[model samples]
Target chain A: MSKHLKHLLTYVVALLLFVFMGYPFLYMISTSFKSLESFFIEPFAILSWPLNFSNYTEVFTMGLGRYFMNSIIISVTAVTLVVLVAALASYPISRLKFKMNRPLFLLFIAGMMLPIHATLIPIFVLTQNLGIYDSLLALLGPYIAFALPISIFILTQFMQEVPKELEEAAMIDGCGHIRIFWNIMVPMTIPAISTIVIYNFIHIWTEFIFALVLISSPGNMTLPLGLQRFYDEFSVNVPALMAALTLASMPILLVYIFAQEKVVKGLAGGAVKG
Target chain B: MQTVSPVKTSKHLEIKKKKKKWKHTFTICMFIAPALFIYGLYVLYPILSTFQLSLSSWDGNPAGPTFIGLDNYIRLLSDPIFFKALRNNILVVLTSVFIQIPLGLILALLLFAPLKGLRVFSTVYFMPFLMSTVAIGLLWIFIFDPINGPLNKFIQTLGMKPVAWLGSPDTAMFSVLLVIVWQFAPFYMILFKAAMVGIPDELYESASIDGATGVKKFIYITLPLLIPTMVTSSILAIVGSLKQFDLFYIMTGGGPSNATELMGTYMYKNAFLSFNMGYASTIAFTMFLIAFIVTVIIQVLEYYRRKKGVFS
Candidate 1:
């Protein structure tokens, strides 16, 4: 009887913790669609309010459109490059019987330990020197670098998993290295690549430090920078802020709704090992 | 008679082998070129320059920078603010391992049970990780706002005085810690739950055969197997806490006399607010140092624990 009671108690605790963990998100959604009068009054009214879409309208009109556009451009461009580079680089490093391969692998892994905070001032100075300090390209350079180690690590592990026998068979058929890589290896790693793209997209989309310090002008602000503007002022309408936040999270949420499985597959393995 | 000709041809084949070595070198270069060129030009070069800047002194203003060797490093060593920042980072590390991770583990264990609607509960728990940290900070700021905030309201409802959460110096660091842990524990919970699922069923089955209690089985079987994963998770938690920027930067801005300042926040304050490029580089190096040290220590600890048969 006590064993059954204990099982019952654990489930109750799980439900309560789930609610506690998710309250802010629920509250944000609630507050975003809420009438101004009902903002503070509807504390935990999970089932009470009708949806209001005005805040989203306010978000698009009030300069967040550009930020949203910029986020897309930066994340897409960066993630694509990170994947392409990681694939090519990781392929040879994992496959080729070269003398310096292990050390080279170690080099990128060590680079993983280098903190973004450490690279901040130097990257800013370098960007400034290159005359692109306030440009989108400047943000991509450091983000790509910072993302390389993990991308390469993940990609290398994935590339190594491809059957050597397939490559051997292709080699015996007079196929060249590039042909085998394109036709045989690339297809197998697509899931890993997709996971990389999604993970890196979310990571780069939300990255604020490089964006904040590197790009000063309003014309170049990313979502984190734009969200920060609301934070700077004394009286940003809480509902409007929530509205903008909800909009900012759309890409991540939409992707997650479909791709949470792949994400768990990707990170759970990497997380356990490293 | 043909044997003589075959031996002569075999000697000539050695020349072909020499040329094949060069061809292999070319193929290797072709494969690695674009990756190296891009990474070298952008990522590798920036890190090198940052390390160089850490050794010099210059404010990052339009006049460019003047070189004063080791001043930033000297200043960092003697600076009270840097020490305070380091202390706060350590607190984040401690709270993660001691409070957050353990709580996450227990929560995950509960959530991993064969209860009804566990899937729905799992999704709900992981919701915070998918949300924006900036939005989270803003929400919590209001939640802990001394006036008309939920925290104070709850206290008032209980017939108690309100505590200044984000306002007071003494409470501020703990307050920030609380907010971060709340936002992040769900993440650890889901990750830990996934790890728990990988533990083999036979371990539990065997333990049950030996008449082991559930708690005893967990301590003996589950925790040992999960140690390596927990270590890696803890490292991520430690580093994430160390490099935490958006939440602390927006919520507190390391104010109330630098009470809530972390390494990442302090680096920003130095680099941007003061335009002290050299000092910021030094602080950045300081972070790199701490991360490197912590990572090394974790590796060593893992080694020793394994050597001592602690996990086995």
Candidate 2:
């Protein structure tokens, strides 16, 4: 084929693939807006009528609002602990060379590689023994552990790139280690910190396995669990389920839209390093 | 100018100053202590305890477990569903590494290409991955509804009849696989795109000048350069797919004959539903071992690959 033909062919194929890639999500958003009577038909009917938001209303009314709240609380806590702890932890590993530094860095990186499926049962049992099995604590603790390695890894990567002269100059002024870290390292890592925060947010937000295994208490369901529960109760209510699904996903969706460039750049390296 | 003290007291102050020279240790310890303690308490200990628990029978309702060496593993080997789950887990991993990578790369390439509207396109393509499993499960359930779903709707558009997808054993595994790929392709795409950015534009420009075309450029340049990342992402994808439970739980519930049950889902049923903590712990160990082995293999392979290459 001619180069023009090849380029055209590639572009055409891409457009088609893009549509196919997005169809289910498009179907989801549309179905989220579809009236119950028109749920299945609207896909073919081409929506000559006005879009409805009653499903959204029903979803909110039907306990998703509470699930939303629970998810926000758990995710916020998990992200907070992950960012704060990883920030503190990455300082020594990144700036201060010590014995077994390389090995210790590898250890945390290995944690990034370790799949938590292996650790699921023990978490469940541990939570039960601690008697907080159904509370947010169960969810909060593991998320911090699971998220630590990556947050630390990324922060260290960013920290290693900062100019050492700044810290050296500070040290010359009689600053203590904590002051140097808090005043210099922390501020210097804001971009990386925000990036880490967003990554942790998305991960904790979408994380399902630990939540699935540990959160047995219906009252403490996260968004993932809440959506699962919504599905169980409203399996046939396609519009409402679609609405709940859309709502469950929209926060991160918008977050991705606004921060996508930063997200993509940060993730490209971070993800494959896993 | 300092406070007047005896020579012996001055020596003690000097010792404290020497100790303070290792101050990074304090910051390091303080930084790592909180995360390490929590992780060690919650994550690391449980892994060892689960292994210990697997060696014995206990409903976990009691204060202690009865030691029964290797009995749970023996029983697990004898069970057919155990075999089924193992096969299914392997199938999920294999399909994900072999099929999903290529698919995700294709999508990533499209997003990277001069294709119009790249931003909107990539974002939409990445949406399913962003969607919670709960929502994706429900969406696929509709697609697999056998009557009113888009999968069926499009099938009939081609003048073919819609068949029950999730309703049959043979089709059920593939059904879940479709959802798996849909949900995770963006992860690889995002990773590959990052790698693509690192590639010097001149290499592609040089290739084009040599009369190299699209696929040729991708093959000679993109593929070779991305091998490390590809390998890394594949390891992640394989490990992740091995333990997938949310979709398996919400969609088929490991059903139509338990055909779609991965080890993670099976462990949940055993440990939580049936309260067979011992057998469940056994299953958990097997998964841990598999994940550990696979991860180590990737790291070693990457290590060797790095050694042979000039790059780190």
What stretches of model 2 exceed 4 Å from their correct place? A40-50, A272-274, B1-14, B21-27, B310-312
> Interface RMSD for each candidate model?
2.1, 2.0
Q: What lDDT tens digits, residue by residue, belong to model 2 across residues A1-274?
A: 8978878988888877677778887777777788888865665454525788899999888888888888899999889878888877788888887885687677777776565766777888778889888887888889998888888888888889879999999999998778998899989988888877877888788888788777876778888888888877787888898888888888988887888776665555466432
Each candidate's DockQ score against the native complex? Answer: 0.60, 0.62
lDDT of 1 by residue, A120-196 (tens): 77677778888998888888877787777888888888888889999999999998878887998789888778767
Model 1 chain B worst lDDT run, 10 consecutive residues: B57-66
lDDT of 2 at B10: 86
Winner by lDDT: 2
TM-score of chain B of each: 0.89, 0.89
- Among these predictions, the greatest DockQ belongs to 2
Which of the CAPRI classes, incorrect, acceptable, medium or high, describes model 2?
medium
> Whole-model lDDT for model 1 versus the true structure?
0.79
